[model samples]
Each structure stands twice: as structure tokens, then as C-alpha cells.
Target: MTTTPEILRYAAFTDLPTGGNPAGVVLDASGLDDAAMQRIAAEVDFAETAFVTGRDGDAYALRYFSPIAEVPFCGHATVATAVALAERSATGALRFATPVGPIEIVTTRGADGITAAFTSVDTDLAEFDAPTLERTLDLLGLDAGALSSVLPPRLAFAGNWHPVLVVDDARAFDGFAFDPAEARAFMDEQGWPATITVLHPIASADAGGPRRFEARNVFPVGRIAEDPATGSAAAAVGGYLRAIGAVVPPALVVIEQGRHVGRPGELVVEIPPSGGITVSGRAVPIPDDVG
Candidate 1:
């Protein structure tokens, strides 16, 4: 690389810098190549880092890289990038050309902070075969009985595919464990670099509000054992719920994650009748000391 890129640290999905998923953002990655971006991401040592490689008017081209590999899409990092851009520019609509497809994000500055919402690409779902389901359950230290009867085992895709495992009992959900190496190998085999998303239904904080869920994303391929907040996985969760008819159309789904890692955050998912799901959350700049 000719020069060092300016990397901004931001925590997505929460107002507090220390209370969300931290991601590295390179707003101007003009001269950086893939190798340089990957090296920078590794140096940053976050779960994911976003690079703005190209720009046209209000639209930008973005690439996401984890420490170990390139990812097609990363929700938290996208939010971080969007917020970073909004802070420098204006709060409004922005388009990102990603590996998967084009993503539309809207930034709004509120009293609390700068909140950015991105509508996911077209979503799809696939059920797990018997053998695959059995193997996954085994690796996760869970049995078929522990799974929620409401949401079956399936692969949900928003930008990337993720295994959606919803446990009926919250206790079982919290109690399940797995070997990261084994899980990572299995995920690699399945062509899923994304997290194995585990969700447990929880009571909504507001009466008669959106459906609430507590989430734990297992991804041991990188620096983190568990993601504090997984925006892409949360988007896939919205698709899974909508596809499975778990929630009514035009519903709102609330996902609370990161408490396990002590970085509690919330993601607001808006499900329309038939289209991309919108995941919204605020991002805050991470202090240099926290980096």
C-alpha cells in the first residue's frame, strides 16, 4: 500500500461506544487492493471491517473483510460505515453496491445519536436435511427436542446464508455449547462463513409491541467467539420469521443481543408485506482508549 488508510472505529447497534459490535471503517479506500484491505482488517482485529472502494454521487461501492476471509456482506460494519459517512457528510439516503447486491441505507440524526437503517437484499430460506440437521444439532450440543417447534431448522439468507437455530426453552438456548474449531470446520464445509444464529423468544418490553427475541451468534472463525451484535444475522432472522409465518406481515421484530458478552444492544427489524426486511440501529464512535 502507498499510505496508511484512516480507519474509524465505531460500535453499531447501540448508542454507547462500549455497548455494541465494534467494526472498523475505511471511508476512503481508493488506492487499497484486496490484500491491503485484508491486512488492514486483520490489523484492526475486529469481527469485520468495511472498505469504501469506490463512490459515485451518493452511491458507494463497499467491500467487507473479516480478519481471516472476505465476507459478502456484514451488517454491523455496514451500519458503522454508514454512520461514519453521515457524520462527515449529510444524513439521508445512501446506496451501497455490495458483493451480494445493492443495499439501500437511510441515516437519520436523532436526539440520541445517528441511526442508520439498511434494507437487506432479497431474502431466501432453505430447510436442513435430516443428516445435516442431526450433525448440526450434535455439534451444537443440542438435540432435536431442544429446538423450538415454532421455528424449524433452516438456512436463512439476507445477504449471506446463516443457520437459524431457535431454541424453545431460553435455558436450553443459553446452555448450548460447541467447539469453535469444529463449528468453524462445519461452517466452512457448508459454505457458510456467517454466524450460526441462535435465538430465544422473549417478552417484549413494550405492551403490544413487536415480537421480541434474545440472540446469541456463534462465530469462532475470527477474533470473537460470540458476536455481540450481528446485524446481518438479525436481518436473516427477520426473513426466517416472515417466511415461516411466525409473525404477521408488516410486523416489527425486536432483537436484543450482546448481553452475554456484556455489550447489550438492540436491533429493530421491520418486516413489510413482501420485500426486503429493514434493520435499524444507531452507531457510536468507539473511543481510542477502547480500541
Candidate 2:
């Protein structure tokens, strides 16, 4: 008997139902096979959909799928799934066995709403060679001069890989254009990162406050111009900053994203001295009527 799994919708990185990235969450997907999950994701047509296939005690086996294919991990979907689970059960610590590895998540409820913070798998980073950087810039319709000297381009990984490009001028960063098909091909040729994150430094920590940035995460293959809130990309950014000696360990960075898409959202990143980065956000259930 083929039973239909219930699909829950949530917007991650923002408590507001209208803001943030929307994701589909299947709390009980044990009966669904990989093909069925992919079909469900395609039908949902969100940036990503998460399926909870198995559970033992507090730990759950998770799989992430985009509208097109399966992904190793997804941060926004993780937050949405965690918040969904917390609402059903209790708010506290939970473990997820993801394709990458085990991810630890802590859920807490405050006066406002439920919030979830997920610690990513071990993070790694590498600088882009000159030719590769040039090709990347060209594909994005960006020039070398637009690149920020403080935070150069690099490939960062925390569960999934992302190319972090810090732009010196916010205007140029916002205005650059590229063909989706071309960009997707280039990305596929260059290792298929989950997203290409372009950031503009809003405020520096040396200026007497927490380091802040505004970001636009591009994932052309997903058929979306920009992702509203990218938790995995934010985690990768933390790794990039730490590995490049841009931030002192044990720092908190605020990333403001999705403004360009008109669905503004925020992601908080915590960087420790070593290991994986932690990305925190709140997710709210998106009413079925909204979609």
C-alpha cells in the first residue's frame, strides 16, 4: 500500500511566515524510497526539501533533496525540520545522521518562538587559484576590481561546498548579471557547490560591533535567481573567514540575506577555534494557504 507522507512547510531564518527560505519537511518518510522523495521535492518546488527517514532515540536519519536532485546537506531545510520536530516533541538537543556526517542541533523556545542552532560537520577551506578566480569572476559578470581585498575569494566547505566572494562595493555586487544556464554549467564543471555566495561587508568588528555582512546566494541550477536564506552557505562563510584569518576565533557574525529578493532574512554564525561552524536561525510554519 502506497501511503502519502504529509508535507510540512516552513520558512527558515525568520520567524515571520512571509520571510526567509521556504522548505518542505517530511517528518515521517520511512516508507518513501529515493524516487518518491525526489518526486515529492519536485512537486513541492522549494529550494530544498528534507526527509526524516529513520529515528532512534533522539537521533534521526536525514536526507535532503532539491527540486532537481539529492544534496549532501542543506542548512535551511535542517532548521525547518528541527523546528518542526521541536514543535511536535520537546525543545532541546537532537542529533541528525546526514549524508555528510552526524550533525548536532539544539532547539530552544523563548518568549517569541522556537529557534534552532545546528552545528555543521567539520569545515574546510581552500583559496582559488588565479585562473580559476578569473573564470569565476567572468562567469558572474564580475571584474577583479570589484572583489574585496579583505576577504578574497575562496571555496569553503561545511557539509557542502560554497564559493565565497566578498565584494568591495555593495552596488556592484547587487548589479552584476549572468546567464543561468551558463552559470550552472560553470558551477557543474567546477565541483558543483551548493551556492555561490557574494557578500558585502556591512560593518567591521574593529568598528566596535559584531561583524556584519549582507549576502546574496546564487544557485542557478535550482532555477532560482537567489536563495532567500542559506544556512549552509553561512556556515561555509564562517569557515572561510576563520581559515583566511579574517576573524578571531570565538566570534559571532551576523549575515543579512534575501533583501534583494524582497524576502529579507538573517543568519547568525558562530566560529570556534577549531572544527565545524555553527549556524543559528528561527523557522516558522508556513500556512498551507500561503502556498
Candidate 3:
């Protein structure tokens, strides 16, 4: 029996080829098992990869895998897969049934070319205890004063849980760094799945635009040092913003990530008037035969 090549490349969240997070896209994953999916992701070595199977009406059942394991959902990979499909079949809307819940995507073609935006599952936010916050800071090698009291420490989840730690200033964010081993150890002790450390400066005050934020994600449990672009994290931040009442209803925000490691990606999040958050971005193909 001949095995089918099951992976494709997509650069998520940017129009420029080099500006977004790269994800492995598997358009059809009928026979692939958990082990095979994990192996393919590891071979691609991108932050995340998406596998689509089981069509249900307008929505398709989707699963996400990292190099080491499977995750509930991944935003950048979703964006990448949607755009990849749209580029070939013409731009339109696509729906996904993820481990978390249903996600929606709309693809379009404009003068700048093709693009896509993904809507995440329903979100929730909850505050963390003082001890948890203190321990997390210690793990990251950050001082207590470095955090923003205004933002507070909260566990936000769109599909998966992420603890959002807001920084006092962008300069403090610049100095932010952590030993992955130490950080992983601390997270294990806390019993949290995975944690993403984010630092954000309010976007320029000029246009009253949606707040702009920068983020860094650590997925030690997934055996990755950092993620270039994260959609789940973006939804978590949206939930955090809404929980604090910092953002008004019908909010749209832009998240800039992946710059530190050179693969920069963007995520645009839309907070609905009723509920749930939508994350949108672009995904471009990576040549299949490239070695």
C-alpha cells in the first residue's frame, strides 16, 4: 500500500510570506491516528498543525496537534488551513468543529490578494489567587512590580486555559525572559495545562483603535519553547479584556506576536455583542516538495 503525503505548509496571520506563523495543514485526515498526526507535526516542526475530517453540514470536524501532542484548538493553524483551502477553491466561508467547539472562518480576495479570519469558540475568564500569581512570577524570573495591577492575573480560555500576565511597560516586556525548564517545572507544580506569558502596550492613542497587544507563548508541556502566532491566546486575551470591562461591546483588537524569534504573525480578534470571540488572519501555502 502506498501512503499519501499528509502535510502542507501555511504561513498564518500575515500577507507577507515571511511575516506570519507557519503551520502544517492536512486537508484530509481520514485514516491518520493520534500517533501519526503527532509524528507529522513533529516532522513539520511548526508551532501547530491542523487536521480536518468528518464533514458536518457547513462545518468540518478538526483536530490540532503540536510536535509532541494534541491540543484542543489552535488559532493560527486554523487561519492557515482556511486560507490554504480558499486559495485553491476560491474565497468563501468555512466552519470547523474543534475539540473546544464550533469555529467559523470567512475567506476573501481583495486587491492585496486572499486572506482569512477565524472565529474562536466561546470564552471564559477567572481570576488567579495571589500564591499562584507569585509563584508564576518567580518561575518567569520577573519581579512583582513588573506586572500591571490594572490587568491583574486571570485564567482565560477559549478552547484551552491560559494565564494572562500583563506587564507594566513595554520596556519591562523587552527584558522578559525565562528558563523553559524552570517555567515548565513551575507549571507542572501548579497543575495548569500550559501557560502563555504576554506583555502588551496599549496601541497608539491616536485613532481610538482597538487595543494592540504583544504576546509570547510558552508551551513546555507541548515541548515547544515559543509559538510564533497563537489564536487561542488571542481569544483568551479577548475574554480577559471583556471580563475587566476595559473594552466596550463589539470589540475588535489586533495582537502582534512571533517577532522575538523572527517569524512574526498577526491575529485580529472580534468580540461579539452577544458572546464568543472571533479571531481572523491569513495563511499562505508552503511549497509541498520543499526539503
Candidate 4:
């Protein structure tokens, strides 16, 4: 008898199928080894793929793989996979024991769709050492003069590390363009620090409960040129803002990404007074043929 894991496709962060970042989910990867998982991820060819290896009483062992290699964690894939599990079980919370640590996921069914919220591991924010920032700006063809002084560049980590760079407006974020080959070389030289999160704050016209932000992730990484929405990056941004004291406590930050790439999506990041950041989004199944 031959056994094969069922690969599920889901787009996270958007109710509509046309938007959001697509992720590959393997619900039961108990028997798949490292090589097999890598092969599956490459075959799926999304920015990232998630595999579930074991299910304990309350926690599932989770692993994430990019097309190039394995990563410690991924947020959008967690949201997508959590919604898939929530559909089959009662409404409540599910926990995943990732390589980084255990992350709690809560799911709900609503008129819009099945939404999953995942609390990231405690974030560690750091300043990029010296010339790393300068090198990054050069690679992107950006000047330090164009960046916003209020929100300076910093390195943030939840499950993975992403450099948070803030510009004055959408115009600065939209103007960023880079060569994939040169970018790849830079990443390799700089030790492959996930994706660089470039962001611009969208001011609220009215008094605030929710703050809006626009972001783009260096146009491309891995095999994909653009990710419609990035949950891990959003989490990192939340951590960065909190560390920099740029955002008020107990705030809801709404992030927009992938607009220029055409697959627009939104991510809701909730920053509590303290502890891990919570990132929430809906995941819709993508048909095999259509994907």
C-alpha cells in the first residue's frame, strides 16, 4: 500500500481568492522526511509551505519550508493551516509546536469566512549592525534621505528575522525595485535574513482605534516575486513598532501589501500591552486547477 500526504492549498489574509498570499499545507506529514518535505515545498512553489508531522493532545508539530530551504516559522501558512483544521473541528484554539516554539492559534467561523488568529512567539528586536543597513538600501536603489526619520530601520524577529524599513509614504515603498540575482547574492552574503519588510504608515483621517499601514517585501524572495500578504512580516513589523515606541499600546494595525504586484491583501496585527503579537487573517481554499 502506498500512502501519500494530501497537500492543501489556501490563500491567507484575504476573504477573496483574488488577493492574499498563497501557501501550501500538508495536514498530515507524519511519514515525510526532510528531503520529502523539501521536495513537496519546491513542487508547490509558493513563497512558503507548512507541514504538520504529529498531533498531540493539544499541540501539532509544525515545520515550514521555503522553496530554497527550511525556515523556523511562517505566519500566513500557520493561518491557512489553522483554518483548515478549524473547519474539521469545534471552534476554539489550536497550538502548534514549531521549531521556534509553541504558537497558539484561534479560529472562528463568520459571514466573511473562516478566520484564524495566531499569536507569535515573543519578539526580539535589534538594530542592524552598521553597514548592513547601508548595503540593503544600496541594493534596493534607495537613499537614506528618503527614509522616514521617525520610524528608523531595525531588525525584528518573531519566528524569523526581517529587517523593518519605513519610508515616508506609499510613493517610497512603491518606487522600490531590485534585481533578483543581485538581491539573492546580497542575501547570501548577508546570511539570508528572510524577507526585508518595507513599510509606510497610512494616517487615519479620523480619531483612531485602528491604524492602517502599507507595505511591500522587496518585490521578491524565494521563487515568488511578490507575496500578496505576509503574516510573519506583519508580526515582525508589530514588534518593531512596539520596540521603537512608534505605536501606542493595545492597538490594531491593519497592513496592506501586494497592491503593486496586483494581488492585494490585508492583514490585521493586534499588539497588546505586552507579550506576543497576534496576527489574524482569513484563508480561502484555492482549487488545484486554478492555482
Candidate 1 weakest ten by summed lDDT:
202-211
lDDT of 3 by residue, 207-268 (tens): 67777888888766345677778888888888878888767868888888888877888888
Which residue ranges in model 2 land beyond 4 Å of their true spot? 56-58
Each candidate's TM vs. the true structure?
0.97, 0.97, 0.92, 0.95
Off by over 4 Å in 4: 205-209, 219-222
Candidate 4 — worst ten consecutive residues by lDDT sum? 218-227
Which 10 consecutive positions of candidate 3 have the poorest summed lDDT? 282-291
Quality of model 3 by C-alpha lDDT: 0.78
User: With candidate 3 superimposed using the best TM-score fit, by how many Å does residue 53's alpha carbon deviate from the native?
Assistant: 2.6
State the RMSD for candidate 1: 1.5
lDDT measured at residue 136 in model 1 versus the true structure, 0 to 100: 88
Whole-model lDDT values for every prediction: 0.91, 0.91, 0.78, 0.85
Cα lDDT tens digits, model 4, 1-291, are 537789999888987666788999999999999999998999999888999999766799999998878888889999999998887777678999999899999999898778899999988898888699999998888888878988888988888888888888566678878888788778767664467788887865255547788888852556676567888889988888888887778878899888977778889999987789999989999986665
Please, what are the lDDT tens digits per residue for candidate 1 over residues 84-198? 9999989999999999989999999988879999999988999988888898889989878988886788999999999999898877888888888898899899899789998
- Where is model 3 more than 4 Å wrong at Cα? 188-194, 204-207, 221-223, 288-291
Better of 3 and 4 by TM-score: 4
Deviation (Å) of 214 in candidate 2: 0.6
lDDT string, candidate 2, 1-291, tens digits: 899899999999997888999999999999999999999999898899999999856689999999888999999999999999999999999999999989999999999999999999988988788898898899888989999887878999998889889998877988988888888788879886589899999999988978999998888745576889999999999999999999999999999999888788999999999999999999999997885
